[model samples]
Target: MALTKKGEFWYGTTSGDTQAELRSYSVANEHEASRFAASKCDCGCRTFALQSDEDAGVAIRTCTDCGQEHLMGDSADHLDDAAPETHECVCENEVFELMSGVSVTPGTHDVRWYYIGCRCVECNLVAVFADWPCDAGDAAAFLAKV
Candidate 1:
């Protein structure tokens, strides 16, 4: 089947006195380069952040059908602010906020990559991070951090 969003995506809900909504996200910022795939929903239906190539101080995200881009004033890709290129992967210690830990194999060590963990502060063990393109040194530096 196609990867098009058709059904009503459960953005959030209202329980007791709580309400939630869908959020767009980005993998980079203006000072930094962009990463990951755009125009797709994050893992599960949760509040996702967005990044952009503009200087509105607001993040940008495009709608799948209409192709209309939306602005998010609160989201950001602060990797440049704190996380440098060295912490770009798992094999290192970059798995603090949005990752568990980096992994490598003795066999396919030359052809492997790392995965991200989670960024949610309220829920522990809740991973919604995606695969970020990285290299060996990046992973090594990450490991050195821890």
Candidate 2:
């Protein structure tokens, strides 16, 4: 079975089955909604259990197979969680350099590239493309902007 997202809900489907199983969460965020929906999954292969503490502003999900616990939610404001790390993005266009930073040590190089966000320009979205290693030339360009 595979889980695919459509709008706000994550729909689950099995290979041989023609029917799709559906689930949704009362929460707002897509990630949170997906996790919530995971709990409702019918597949017996993957099992999820949630442990929540409202007063502490924290919730965790445990995977029975891997024994790993993942944070489900925190009482913290949603702004930081949904806010984009970078404001400049090219949307569906080619990636354009917005800003970058770098640190060099003997044999080690640490580079951070801040690309434009993925949303359309008119949307006035604040997000960034995934960060990437800044090559020397790109690093030079990014540094000039900084």
lDDT, candidate 1, 12-41, per-residue tens: 111110111111212221111111212232
RMSD of 2: 18.0
Total residue pair clashes for candidate 1:
14
Each prediction's Cα RMSD? 16.4, 18.0
Worst 10 residues of 1 by lDDT: 14-23
Give the alpha-carbon lDDT of every model: 0.27, 0.27
Q: How accurate is candidate 2 locally (lDDT)?
A: 0.27
Error of 2 at 115 (Å): 32
Candidate 2 stretches greater than 4 Å from native: 1-45, 74-146
